[model samples]
Target: MRIESVHATPGVSGFYFDDQRAIKRGASQDGFAYEGDPVTEGFDAIRQAGEALLVEVELADGTVVRGDCAAVQYSGAGGRDPLFKAEEYAPVVEGPVADAVTGREAEEFLANAELLEELTVDGDRLHTAIRYGVSQALLAAAARARRTTMTDVVADELGTEPAAEPVPVFGQTGDDRYVNAEKMFVKGVPVLPHGLINAEEKIGSDGEALLEYVEWLVYRSRELGPEGYEPRLHVDVYGMIGELFGAPYDRDEVVDYFAALEDAAGDLPLQIEGPMDVGDREDQIDAMCDLRAGLADAGVDVDVVADEWCNTFEDVRAFVDAGAADVVQVKTPDLGSVHRSAQAVRYCEGTDTRAYLGGTCNETELSARACAHVALATDAAQVLAKPGMGFDEGFMIVENEMRRTVARRERDRSRAAEEVTAGD
Candidate 1:
């Protein structure tokens, strides 16, 4: 079906736009410390209700489908900043942008959105925020047009079955986040631990500091939860490894650092993310490949994840093809289209690389839930639960969506089984 018209409006979100680069040095939430000393922590983040470009698409059949846009703060890891204002997204959804996209087939919506990004005068593309907002709107529209869920739409496009197990929920917290994680663990919720990108600056991205944080996470989960086991650890250095160990990366030093972390982590499986934000895509491939090789030489079993410069479909393939990372965090908004994100996941699946469908805490509830559908469809390594900078709200929202989605899938399967039995 063709889109008859597309309209946009101010939408509500359960998150905020935060510039961690500007956050002040102060501790909040569960005894975790924030040292913004390097960048001069001059500002504090306000957890205000965020805004989304809520798109309503009317199909030729006169049916309406709804979708919304949400983005991570920090300027899309610095690619495009639509300069999101409080009232609405900086890239207003209207005019020729809408006109160019209207009356297009739903399946063509993503490519058409890319065309809009390209056709913008002066070679400046629309902010990645707008791309995400618009493309997902079309995908949602496509799914509705087929009378199916977004997850089903993705499965059809990617030729994959929905994962039978509910997508594992990955949640991060420091300090008091333990209490929150403990509560969920007690209820048989398998909430995994994700340590922030070196938010503990006092230890200076040292392995010891991460060990302290992981210990707290493991101890709390084991002590409080029914399962007497440690949560798998994913530590996001956020490129602070460069701050600790200088660039022009020393292979031995890099291996040593991971070796230290491996010892500290003991038996817990360690997944390291953004150990270094190697500048160019070429450099990133080289550095990550060397690290991957170095870690193997040093007998470190760390899973290296690439996030920063790996922003697009091409970027993801480049990293995966080069065997540069164990997992690539498909930052949702950076893909410009959630469908492209699905393609990225499928691409990773087809290769040796693993996909971690992740966004930032800056995302809203709508985007997070939408990502839930994407994660379930692709069977990503794990989906980052977001919309909460702290441990509680975002975790609740994401886990609830997973549970609901699985329940729906189970009921569908049960009916299918019944039909077969009745026919027999």
Candidate 2:
């Protein structure tokens, strides 16, 4: 089968893009939007409607495969690409991108994805969002051509088995942390709420607020969760802890605070993402290494996740090789192609670092579902339920996709077994 045509369209994402620098500098929230000018270059407002480029590739058989190109919620920070404007990118996709894939064989997903990664229009590689979406479309197109599931295509190419069951889905609660967390416990989400404690105030001047919040999370999980429902408590502090204690992350105060957090959680597993953003990649890794070592020495069981400055496959490898993080969040958009994300996840296979296939809430359902297939194929430790902060919508999209894919694959395997038995 061959690709008949390729096209691009502008669309809106599930969430808005916020200037991370502005937010970090205390941009006040005004209702759903931020109430200040953007501090990041390329951003017009502190918060703007998230944009996505919809890549649609039509096969010769009239089947259409889709993928959404989207950036992170906090674009233009942490060494990520600039804000994704669908309008500006639509022409590129329709012109050079379409030309590249238009008459190509549709069954070679890995090769096509690699070509797209190295594809350049004007002496510059395509944006991460473009590569991400185009790779997703190609993967789906390959599956359609082979009449197999996308999971199967990925597993075959990577020499890994597709997950027999759904990967654990982690949910994030925008600012409605308490109510949404209760909802998560009730629903038996394997990973509880990502308490978005980004600001200093949220962490408290002396770090009391975060401690209080962790205690509350433990209490509510026990009270509301189903029997045998001990979910991992993951929170994205966005470097507030680092801010509160000030650098040299292995300090006595930092160790004591993490110990306190662990005690508060009782027995629930706790992982903190982006504990500090020191504005440099090497420094960030060094700090995380110190913090992880300190926690281990103090007998604190909290896991430190690396997010900021860990934006690419190379960065993930650096962290894994150095033993800098307990969990390395493979932020999908930041890595450019979905296959790169898979490689990053696989890179952590025998290492102490666990790969959390995570992406921003500022994405589309198509992108989120595509990531679901990647997580299952790579056997990531946990996959994030995302596209929006609304606890239910994002969760439903990702969880359902994984469940349906697994079911279909299992049914196929059973039917093949039955056929073999009949042949015998």
Please name the candidate that would achieve the greatest lDDT relative to the true structure.
2
Write down the TM-score of every candidate: 0.84, 0.98
| lDDT of each candidate versus the true structure | 0.70, 0.91
How many clashing pairs per prediction, in order? 1, 0
Candidate 2 lDDT (Cα, 0 to 1): 0.91
Per-residue lDDT of candidate 1, residues 105-135 (tens digit): 8765446655655656335666666777777
Error of 2 at 10 (Å): 0.2
Candidate 2: stretches off by over 4 Å? 247-250
